[model samples]
Target: MKKILFAFALSCIGFISTNAQSLYNSNSYFGSSSSTSISSTNSSVRYQQGYTRKDGTYVNGHMKTRSNNTNHDNFSTIGNSNPYTGSTGSVAKDYSVGAYNYGSGKTIHTGSRGGQYYINGNGNKTYVPKRRTRY
Candidate 1:
């Protein structure tokens, strides 16, 4: 009799657990997740980490200008530690081609004719060909 009662109780508990549902539902999440790294065309050091969702876009990345190790210094970089984070549209604002030079009165543009331009002051648009950083 005791064995039968115990088996019944165990079955009852198992049934209750099976019916329980998870508190956190995946439907509550916004914009499924899509993450990727943007690689530099010239070199491998420059990369961007972020997500591009069908609903919205976000980017966060870094540029390696300087190395953390001082003993094996072959090159020096700037703003490697600093991060760029914002909507994908934010890149447009940062890389304006028509950056007006209030002092020069001449507008500087980046990218080719096929590409759009946004001009910004203090925007140093320079590119250095990628090369071997290590021997």
Candidate 2:
């Protein structure tokens, strides 16, 4: 009886571990950055060069300065100073929104994991993935 219980416990542990690994991979696959290149436009660039961490993990995305824009809807503008960051802006920004572009939204928020997302009309967070730019 002891041997049978031990075997069952080990099998259960192995099965649980396998499921955990699959779940981690599915969610963290994009966390492993593989981008390469620098953007030269004032417009928000999708992917920048990624760097490997001390733990051999790759972190993607580069720091970008706040863009200058005059769109009243944009919080970065002068009179429309960002309520979150309290930063003012100018009169030159792209005011277009595509199916996947979250920057064009009235507000862009950072996720708990440092991802970019926007609040949809339904009051749900819509995470925007970093798109790969064609070289």
Candidate 3:
């Protein structure tokens, strides 16, 4: 009878602990119970409502936005760190090559493959080929 009582007690404790963990993860935030995100081709927004992780890390409630040519202050850019991930941006400040100040107002922009490029008068990406190294 003593063995049976002890077994029951242990089972009850286990059940209670399991339920408590589930409850905390579902209702309380140290990690996400649920999350929402909206994204576009050029922009995105994420809302994390105070989630707690299983590893004991606490994620505070916050909203993140990424957009092109935004007028508001952007913390995800160079010289700033992302509040959620604590990662810093890597682009240099002088990344922009600027416009061709000769006469036309066409601005120079970085291309997808890490090449210096500018939109030609034909309205297309014209990548500047690197100088060939002589053998």
Candidate 4:
């Protein structure tokens, strides 16, 4: 009896060790990262002419300067604009109700009615006939 118990314990330990080693060796099956290269090259020439002083100072003529602007009031109007007008009259309708508005006057069924009705996550109503009650 003692020898049988010892042998069983030894076999269990050996089996556990073998399984652990196999799992350790299978690490490469999970995933591996290797170095990769990405390269892009384009050869094209684009040129544009702008204002330049006699002293060789180049100035961007196309760029608008804020100092010489005539429409500072437009900038003020945009900067001081309110994103939300705070009008309470605009009642937000539930999108789930929109599904019922397509001719079916039923709210989207959430699957809580365990009998013959189940509402799906999209709020669309579905009729699942109830199973026969077991007496």
Candidate of highest TM-score: 3
Q: lDDT of candidate 2 vs native?
A: 0.45
Q: What TM-score does each of the candidates earn?
A: 0.18, 0.22, 0.23, 0.22
Clashes of 2: 2
Tens digit per residue, CA lDDT, model 1, 1-135: 997996686566445433321211232332236243322111223332456755476654433323322212112222111222221221211222322222233333335532323344556443221222223
- Residue 71, model 3: lDDT of 14
Model 3 TM-score (2 dp): 0.23
Whole-model lDDT values for every prediction: 0.31, 0.45, 0.46, 0.34
Which tens-of-lDDT digit does each residue in 1-135 have in candidate 4?
Answer: 997996686566556645644554453544455233311111111112378876699976331213221222111221221112212222112222322233233332324534234466666555432233225
Write the residue-wise lDDT of candidate 2 on 21-94 in tens digits.
Answer: 46544535545473533212223212235789666999864423343432334444333343223466543333
- The regions of model 2 sitting more than 4 angstroms off are 1-100, 130-135
In order of lDDT, best first, we have 3, 2, 4, 1
Q: Is candidate 2 or candidate 4 better by lDDT?
A: 2
Regions more than 4 Å wrong, model 1: 22-135
Off by over 4 Å in 3: 1-63, 68-72, 93-135
